[model samples]
Target: MQNEKIINYIKNWLDNYLVKTNLNGFVVGVSGGIDSAVTSTLCAMTKQKVLCVEMPIHQDISQVTRAQQHIAWLKSNYNNVSSVEVDLTPTFDAFKQGLPKTNSKREDLALGNSRARLRMTTLYYLAGLHNYLVVGTGNKVEDFGVGFYTKYGDGGVDLSPIADLMKSEVYSLAQTLNIIDVIQNAEPTDGLFGDSRSDEDQLGASYDELEWAMQYEGNPEELSSRQAEVLKIYKSLNSANQHKMKPIPICSIPSEFK
Candidate 1:
């Protein structure tokens, strides 16, 4: 994670995609976590406009402080970083009330995913209004290789700055690139529910371990007992999140393909 090369790549990507798309800057959903911090830092380093937004739901406001910390640090560090606040509790509650009463983990996942979608939809709407692109913060530990993000929810973004970097690699790059310490150290969370439950609590294992298992022990043809479990987890994440990576459907060859 050399600082110079990291900065160069980030700048190159920003120029190639964002500049080519005629976007003024990137609008990011900063959750007061490591991934968003690093992603926002990359955008800042690129000398691009960075909109750091705090879109919280019914969860506790503990993360809001971290968002502010990220904002304060960004104000000092980045040239064009700004922030906005959007509380999504009402939208989430409206959707939750429309659903039937089923209080299960699967049901909770659905509700939480709806909230994530709401946040993403809002981000995109703002992106369109501001002539910006939505910048995604999901890292390799969460999206690639292991693939743990919600379909078309948290994974839907105009650009994913850290999609290829693993969890360990993300932290390494963040430290090398001098991201804010508070954000670099904060526990990763979706904040869909109350009190900020952890990804590991829901995933049954930490992100690094899952990535290691995917890289080393995974064998699609024949797996050992432990490897089977890893494969199962990986496949479950991939299958569940497939919609995020899919292209929107169109009518025919001339219309859609062409």
Candidate 2:
């Protein structure tokens, strides 16, 4: 129940995974928010060589400043850490230049997804070059319950150490670790679009209420109308985005079983 215990548990679990898999290190994308900051710190504390990448795409100064702070915090708080910043604005534009003229909706969505894929691709390249597994920053409330993350974007990673923790729990752990304010208080953002939308705002209910409805509930029919609405949004996103979480199916694997 304690935050320190949870972090220790995660650290030990990661140590075991690294030993079994024989990975030399990890690479994580830090977004200047509490989740990424805390996740990176944990990795650094585990005696892993961590490469923290800041891939900002047309972001404002505030976001960039927080990112620098994250890097500084990582240096002062822990060793065996290196930082890199690559602006993705040009990359996003180049990809868009080749696309056919469609409605703004398609263009925008495509552009956003492309940025995510680009970040993952770059991370993978770095992973291969440096022999480090990509450490994901998604938390339990984001990935499991409602599927709030971008497919192939933030969701593409080899492992997510904090995937099982709720948002509140993540913050609690950050406090225990004494993660700085720039990280702990940074307004949560996807850092893709110009405006940042809170994850819960996109979802129908608050994390606490949603967790309660999902964790301890009877039949859906027995729930109140409000509860049903929350369940509907959660299930809708989950079903629609389920494909993103799974690997591409190999349709060419011979038809013997069928």
Candidate 3:
């Protein structure tokens, strides 16, 4: 789809959702990545009240800077756009200190997931206060195919405007929206871990490879070795993270019990 049409569709969807739910506005966590940048921009485009918050939890300065720049750009372009910075470093530190010790990698992974859940909690708190919906920034590959988001964390949201778009498509929309150069050029990171790990670093595959794998048919004989390797990585990730992508399982009681 054309960028303009995509923007209109998302803006209309947000408008319809607010009207349907009787919500006042949207509360989006701007993580200084293209996904968040694009999502926030779309929310701002609706001309509805958009609270674009920067929640940094011991985050890198560059990430914060990029988020601030995007917010500034939004404020300049949209009258309804407002921003606030909430540092969750102290909160995260307290939570980390309370956790039981484990292996470094395992602990780091746990802490990173906790940070996402913490941000989700923060967003819900603000959303409740303002009577706004929590807008998510997850894209198709991360949200569905690979389930890269933290369960009940970034995965917890009232609406996801760009959940249907691929990562490459998000970059395309970001370009069309004239997103800030800093954010557009910034590497995609969850900003939930120390040293600022990129999504590719964590996923073991680039977005492009993941996207290809998501669409590619599994025919080992027809694929190059490198392609097969990417597909293997994609399948492993999808299998491991399937729980996050699927709905919660519930046991159904027999009707005779009634």
Per-model CA lDDT versus the true structure: 0.79, 0.80, 0.92
Compared with the true structure, what per-residue lDDT tens digits does model 3 show for residues 1-258? 598998999999999999899989999999889999999999998899999988898889999989988899899999999988888999999988887777776777888899999999999999999999999999999998899999999999998999999999999999999998888888899888857789899888999999999999757789998899899999999999999988899999999997
True lDDT of residue 218, candidate 3: 59
Listed in order, each prediction's TM-score against the native is 0.85, 0.88, 0.97
Q: Compute the lDDT for candidate 1.
A: 0.79
Model 2, backbone clash pairs (residues 3+ apart or across chains), number: 0
Off by over 4 Å in 1: 100-105, 217-232, 239-258
Please give the RMSD of candidate 2 to the true structure.
2.5
Ranking by TM-score: 3, 2, 1
lDDT of 1 by residue, 1-258 (tens): 576786679768975798789879889898888888888878887788888888888766768888778878987987788889888888777877887887576886777778888989989988988999998888877776556676777888887877877888888887887877877777778777767788778786677768766587434577667667766787677677565556776656665556
Per-residue lDDT of 66 in model 2: 84
Off by over 4 Å in 3: none
